[model samples]
Target: MRFGPRLLMALGAAASLLAACDSAPITGRSQMMLVSESEERQMGLQAYQQVLSKEALSHDAQVTALVDKIGRRIAAAAERPPGELWRAPRFRWEFKTVDNKEPNAFCLPGGKVVVYTGILPITRTEAGLAVVVGHEVAHALARHGAERMSDQMVAQVGATAAGVALAATVGGSNRRYVPMMMAALGAGATVGYLLPMSRAQESEADRIGLVLMALAGYDPREAIGVWERMRAANTGKHTAEWLSTHPADSTRLADIRHWLPEAMRYYRPRD
Candidate 1:
């Protein structure tokens, strides 16, 4: 019996996926990572340059210094043991504060961290700032961006193969149904798989971030308050949790509380 083209395509995709499996740091969650670290870092570097070119860097010396200080501590915590979880790759860490008013921050691959000045008001204090920075750093440490890229690639390939198979099965008589089926598949993948995976990664980042902040000698408990403030700030502006990429504020706070006990185990007040 000859194997059909669809079976061959599926088998190839499965093999590729299996070969690209990687485990995230601290959480030990398995991830699909078709993109190489070097490629990820290069993409990050290019994006970083583009962002820096377009966005104005913060001019407030004191605030900038404070962000740099907090970012350094978080980076150190990420590189060191227990938090490292394994012999992690060395990241050439750099932290810069952007002059934007959006309460946002992110850590690109290889540890390029950018904090918006707008988030400073929400972060409130050093420990509070650590909560935000630590969470962003956790995204980099866990390579979530690369995982997302891999997921998109696989989804696209699966969609293409599915479309081909559907077209062949329907031929001209039922060709009209093919596009509808493809759209349904896309929607199903986004709602059933990608969104949920993204939410899980967000929660995982929160947990890992709590540990990082604690290791950096910041009180992990501050994370709850910081998120509470965030909730207050965003008031009535969130999308439904199932449809959104990030968890709802309530779910996020609950997750942070749950992980706080474990994070506190790593805490040692900074002298």
Candidate 2:
């Protein structure tokens, strides 16, 4: 039997989706990616600029110098001749130390990295700081954000398809309930798929970040110390928000410990 136009379209979409799956650079882990690197980079740049517009940048030259120094080194180390795991050789890397009290830092797509002043105490020396920057850059290098967006896109597409299928089964009177059913399905997808994938991404970043720092001439073992300090700093605060979005400190520390040996193979001290 010949396929209908709709059936043909669906088959083509499925084939395209399968073709879109890619492996991450260093870890070679399979990732569902629908967005293009250039598109993700553009979105990252826009978001980076918007964040800079709202957050106050650090005025202390010392803090800025340290962050820039470490960030540049990480970027250099992460940038592996255009075809490596950190594939975006064209990324115009930018680093800024934000004058914030929150112990947080992130690297946006296209190599935009921001460090909060509060994290400096925990990071301590330049090598310790390298640990943090390396992990953040790992997130960008792995294209975790784009993977997430791709996951969401898939969920939305599935949701829409489900809605259409449901509408076909229901009578006119029951058709009105399709939207409610779709909403619930969307919620379930978020809880079941998106959240868990985010946790995985965090863990993957931790793994790759260690290797990047080690390769960049920074001691990879310092990563454990940095996380230990972070755990100490976050002792009494409510962890629900952070834990929901990230791997627990203990879990991360354990993973770092497990991966340290492999990371060490890449380590070479730079003068």
Scored by TM-score, the top model is 1
Q: What C-alpha lDDT does candidate 2 achieve relative to the native structure? A: 0.75
**Can you list the residue pairs that collide in candidate 1?**
none
Q: Output the worst ten-in-a-row residue range by lDDT, candidate 2.
A: 177-186
Estimate the lDDT of model 1: 0.78
- Candidate 1, residues 1-271, lDDT tens digits: the string is 8998878877765666676789887778999876667766666676677669889999999999998999899888888867337555577888999999999987776688899999988999999999999998898888887777566555665643533442343223332332332232123447766778878888888998998899899999999889999999989797898997789999999889988899999999996
Looking at model 1, report the run of 10 residues with the lowest lDDT sum.
177-186
| Candidate 2 local lDDT, residue 197 | 80
lDDT of 1 at 29: 91
Give lDDT: candidate 1, residue 251: 94
| TM-score of candidate 1 to 2 decimals | 0.85
Per-residue lDDT of 131 in model 1: 95
lDDT of 2 by residue, 3-69 (tens): 9877766776666567668887667889976666776677677767877999999999988998888
